[model samples]
Target: MVCCSLENNDVGWFSRRQSAYQCTTPITASQSCGGLLARIRPTILQIPPIHAPSFMALRRDTLVEAVEFPIHLESIERYFTMTDRRECAFCASEITEINDSKEHVIPNSIGGRKKVRGFICITCNSSFGQSWDAKLAEQLNWFSLAVGIEREQGSCPAKIVHTVDGTELRLRADGTMTRKEPFFQKTESDGKVNIRMLASTKREAQQRLKGIKKEHPGFDLEGELKNLERTAFKVNSALQHRLELGGSEAGRSVVKTAIAQCVRLGIAAHRCEIGIYTLKTPTDDRGFALFYIRDVVIDRPQTDLFHLVSIRGDSEKGTLLAYVEYFGAMRVMVNLSSKFEGDSFISVYAFNPQSREELNLSVNWDIPATELHAAFNGFGLDANNFYLACRNATAIAYHMQKMRERHHVHREELSAVLSQLGIPPGGIPEPKDRDQFNSLMEEKLGSLSEFIKKIPPMPDD
Candidate 1:
């Protein structure tokens, strides 16, 4: 994580501050670790003035050695923020504000917000319900179930897959899950014991109920067994039916998933400057189920609700990009159509039925776009992991283009800068070359002449 400012006291000292730091000494502790700290303890502050102070004296050696530093400051003037009604991040259509409009960043089906602090015009919002958001939810169906998140009742219905015997079937929340067990008794038979299982479902029980008369006309068994086994089966069926998880026939409501995403990326920004990135959900078997859904019977079980949503943004990164991380596990990124303006962390709206709390964190956007970046101190998000894991020339081409266009530079110029960076072209570097690649990319981004201060976006409201 890097906090950039050209306001050092020793301004116009070295070619770039990065070079000055490279020339300084090493230390065990970081300058930015503990917040509310006004200064690095002086004991460890001997490294250099290049760090620590917003202003400092240039080392005589640095002033005498490196080439002349640029005379410009990297301060941004505008800050991008989200608004009530704005353009769609997906369709590029204008979204008008209305009384009923609500955008869920994670989507209502996945236990996301119903009224996130931003908006995704109703049109594009609806389209996403029919398309992108739905597919995203589909991709994460298992995790959602494991997390015990619920879907909005009506328009955004849950797609539940239940396995019976060897077959997999899709189900909506309106009906019940039925399983039958057949119980029959035989009085002292020919030195043998018999066991039978009854109806696995209501329909099957009703269908199988007709056979008691034909099969046992001569047997006389009163007590609870007096009735045809079918009658007893019906009673068991009523008690055994498993009602769906998220109640049935929920009211029709607009989902706010994409809008929540927009808020996370600072939708207050202008549309065109934001960048969007989508990553494939990881498929692996690890950890145990977050919550278990079972039959609601005697000693009733409490459904543990784990519906949490967080919208983290980096407004200082110039381009507003969203990073969706599910706890410390799953992650996704959506670049809004705008630029972020200042240092901001994640704005979390956690819906825990057991507790109520509020949280705010601050993060720097100038940090390296590493695959292991975490939004907050313990967010456990690697925003670029999956994106880089499956990196191809085309996956990042659009954002690269946006970066190029934003700088008003040609590809060759960018390549030349990248080359001088000592970082190889493209972003992938083999494991053995990881450290080298990181150093090079840092150099490339740090020393570019055309790389001016990042500009934040302005709100449309």
Candidate 2:
């Protein structure tokens, strides 16, 4: 049997028996009670406090992910070099003040390893970090909670508001959840679960009822008491759905992060806004807002995390396209150029589920750019003709074959969509001539304006 004692001799910092105790540090012992014959005064016993260095030895009681407190960049010194390029990558404004602040090509809060020197000035960096970057972290943090993905945050507990029994309760804890003044506690002995309420006393409960009655004046105290008594021993309960009280910040950050990579790669500042994936199906399409990129970029991290910034281009595909896709996770590919404003050159490219690599510049696979310009009210281009004007027919046929298989989409559906596209169905006809496909596709696209003109003309009412 193990036993211990808090003897009076070990009560003070200056006590003779203090050395007998394993605890150190100054402790002010409470005043001692006199002898039994003397006044009845209590002596306070001081327990040894566990210092910070010993925290690791304690066992955790709960399992949860670690998340950092939102990162705050204060008066951090501006550092990092800039390219000879004089324009800010984001706003496309002139970067006159070059030496004031440094920019992290990837955000630093969520463990961004790489840094970019300049091209994005300090003011812009700080602004984006506070607004856009903060938004990204919150989205990530919520994702962490929703999926139970553990995050790392030193030794402090992360504050998360989660739903409990359809009610929102804020949980603050590390891997070991801790709560103060819990109204009830639970214990499992046999196969069943149990909840033990900690009501102080019958009188105390009555006082609470009386207080409620006094506050509301019209409350039915007796009826409430009867209901409480009826449910006093009830134990079964079920958890319904959870309603997250958060804002949407996933898709935009993917674009922002990708843009940062473009800025780093020496893409002209104004050209950063080359294309934007349609925001119509933002969340389902873009990412778990791309938290997994962190996993791909870093060593084993706390979750499927972060986004990648891949910016590349070739001359054959005349129009730029930007879109994001999701399967097990989400990734984005975009044309990191702003050629839309100067000349009309645009195309819409779908993210291929099989195409894991970032830059797949298929000259034959593209959509008309004027479509998006019309959709986004112009800030776009038209690239279908530019690419068709330089397409390789065999390669086009091969690319279409791959797309058809990868999507498990029927060839009929493909033909139907292409028919609407006004491109010749002959372009994708039965496998015969190696060189005839491009001509057929061109023949179809050539009569596009005439076909548009010959259509029913909206039928004069």
Best-performing candidate as measured by lDDT: 2
lDDT of 2 by residue, 12-123 (tens): 0010100122222211212111110111111222223322221123222211112121211110111112344566554445666445244554444433444554456666
Q: Pick the candidate with the highest TM-score.
A: 1
Candidate 1, overall lDDT? Answer: 0.31
CA error at residue 90 for candidate 1, angstroms: 4.6
Candidate 1, RMSD to the unseen true structure: 29.9
Candidate lDDT (C-alpha), each: 0.31, 0.31
Give RMSD to native, each candidate.
29.9, 33.1
Model 1 CA deviation exceeding 4 Å by range: 1-85, 89-101, 116-118, 154-261, 264-266, 269-272, 276-317, 342-346, 351-367, 372-461
Per-residue lDDT tens digits for candidate 1, residues 347-386, read: 4443432122232322233333321122111122221221
Misplaced by over 4 Å in model 2 are 1-84, 90-101, 144-159, 167-173, 176-250, 275-306, 320-335, 338-461
Model 1: how far residue 322 lies from native, Å:
2.9
